[model samples]
Target: MDHRGGQVEGGTPDGESLPALLRSWRRRTNPRGIPGLATPGRRAEGLTQRDVARLTGVSERWYGALERGIEAEYSADFLDRLSSALQLSPAERRALYLKAVGRLPTLVLPPEAGMPEDVDEGLLQRFLDNQVPAPAFATDLAWNVIGHNEPLLEWFPWVTRQENQMRWVFLEPEAHEQLVNWEQDWARPFLGQLRYERARHPKNEALMRLERDILASSPAAREMWNRREVVEHSHGALRRLRLQCRRGQEVAVRIVALRPMRSDLLRVIVLMEDQRECGGA
Candidate 1:
């Protein structure tokens, strides 16, 4: 709350400041409100430094120092876990990192918001295109499908139709038909992954909107979300997919998801059909 140290650009463009942002996020969050955000004693209003420290496995005083914007050193791993506990999304994590470095997260803004896509998106597109005849697509940390190959559109054109991958999975009527084992293979794990994502970026407008919309529209989705399951990873595996575009078509494809080394938000997925094992004519 004390900007007397010097006003540094952070949070909102209106110069909301970092400590304010942290405190705001904390105040709005309750122990039972969001997943992984629950702290032991303070469910009445907001989380305390003690709660954050307890969650991050650090001392209360140490956590307080960072929260107060004191010149303190923090490990990436520690920051990551702390972000997870507070349910800080990719954008929030980046912003928090920036504040720690005496810089603002919005220091470099691409045309779009929350896109740390400083990597060569064109080159990545080329790589995705090279996987022709196979379904390949890339998604940001929030699970927004950023890029994809033409082949991928044949089956998952829905993914391209909409930006949010989780929304498409849950909201689309055709999802049940597209994914053979919709409940177990697709929906459950995907929901858990979304749970993790939601926890990380509790303040993301798009994500928050999608969550509200889904919860209101679908009872199933609401139940899954309320369960508050946290999945550390969302790697796709070999599975059967129904080619909705093709009549009487079911393909056994091994779907693999890989995150780029440059940023945690960027993820690439490639689908390989096991033609030999499945005896393709």
Candidate 2:
């Protein structure tokens, strides 16, 4: 590819080109949905190249060259803007980057990577309810507690009232008392997990706000936040904590984290008793 003009020097390996994709996408876009567009007496089906260029903050000539597959250097930002102006889906956007820049955009996670906004709360609740004897709860991308079973509340009664698992872990005084090895096992890894999520989904404002609140409210969280530890998930880890139902006795459990096939953003976490440590609880 010509670095200066951002043109493709060689054909894309997938047998697709940027110009074809751009034309196809632009042709499929409806002008009526776009605000500020004059739709009367229009013979064309989709948006014109000039209209897309205007929306994308580029000159019509430049956009026309792109459509003509003229050899020119293109910046990732410009391509991203073009993708947005054309209303490309996540997959289509990826294809745009791959066809144009020879790589995928670094920051934007696919829509399927997180919980869908229209997820069925009742279904999630039922899924948790089915866990029965095992303590189970559901959390979103930001670790917000969306669903829980009675067994989970038995283990951590605070889950009944808490909205976010991360907030409760970092800010609540009860967390320190109930979590065994609070600093090393619970707080550190959990904070690292939060950091990982923040990096993975930088566009998520809630994660940023949650981090700021925890850092401001808890000295422990502030201290751990600086350590820059990173963990994706605590799945399969054996952890010991004081269960509300068991009172003074410390119970050991294995953590199981799962993402629903239908919605990757929603997490279903189940905690099973460590048979040897708790004697089947």
Candidate 3:
């Protein structure tokens, strides 16, 4: 038991107890005033225990006890939710996970803000540009087509014309025609990614604009967004995209989104043809 006579949970908070840390951090985190929570809550500013419970998907009683430094244990998943609830840094989150579960979380988590000021030119352009035949491009967090190669532009004119992929996917009528399995393959996954990125960078003005623009264009997109789904999307399943071209050809390729180790906001998408489609690219 602690000097306060409360049962110690994982490890003694010592002079720096978990409950004390929670209480301190909770006051410092103002959800309503912050860029998080797309829609602000009715509860007063700063994170409440109830808010933590809801965000972490744990019972108020359970979260409260943990907050009070009582003996407790939770799964790694619970720690993930708890980390988000507390809006902790990756390091801080890791520490919390160890404190709660006596180990690191099974799932990998990106830092709250890991975007580099600039992605090295060689990595972004020089390398991807050489990836011939296979359509390749780079995008910012907003999914804006900041750079691309001749093959990608030649295959998809709409991509060249449009500045942002999200805008094209939802607003441009041609996107539905070009991307096969529109709802399942392209739209849903992209929607989930947008939601995930937004959660991490809610205050970013450019990102906020992107979200507003997307919502303004498509009700279907809005409905999906409201579902509040988030996914850990690095490189996703192989997808078949129907090129919006003269012949309307369809090709199966794995689309990969690569993030540089140091950068949070930069993403590179490369198209790879299936082995059967070899000699085609």
Candidate with maximal lDDT: 2
Reference-based TM-score, model 2: 0.58
Residue pair clashes in candidate 1: 87-199, 87-200, 88-200, 89-200, 89-201
Q: Which stretches of candidate 3 lie above 4 Å from their native place?
A: 1-115, 277-281
lDDT of 2 by residue, 12-49 (tens): 54565666677789999888878877568875589998
Per residue, candidate 3 scores C-alpha lDDT tens digits across 34-67 of 4544464455567888777877787899889877
User: What stretches of model 1 exceed 4 Å from their correct place?
Assistant: 1-113
In order, what lDDT does every prediction score? 0.69, 0.77, 0.70
Candidate 3, after superposition: displacement of residue 202 in Å?
Answer: 1.6
**Cα-based TM-score, every candidate:** 0.56, 0.58, 0.56
What is the Å distance of residue 173 in model 3 from its true position?
0.1
Q: Which sequence of candidate numbers ranks them by TM-score, best first?
A: 2, 1, 3
The runs of at least 3 residues in candidate 2 whose Cα sits more than 4 Å from the true structure, single-residue gaps closed, are 1-115, 279-281
Q: What would the TM-score be for candidate 3 when compared with the true structure?
A: 0.56
Model 3, residue 185: distance off in Å is 1.0
In terms of TM-score, the best-performing candidate is 2
Q: Output the better candidate (1/2) by TM-score.
A: 2
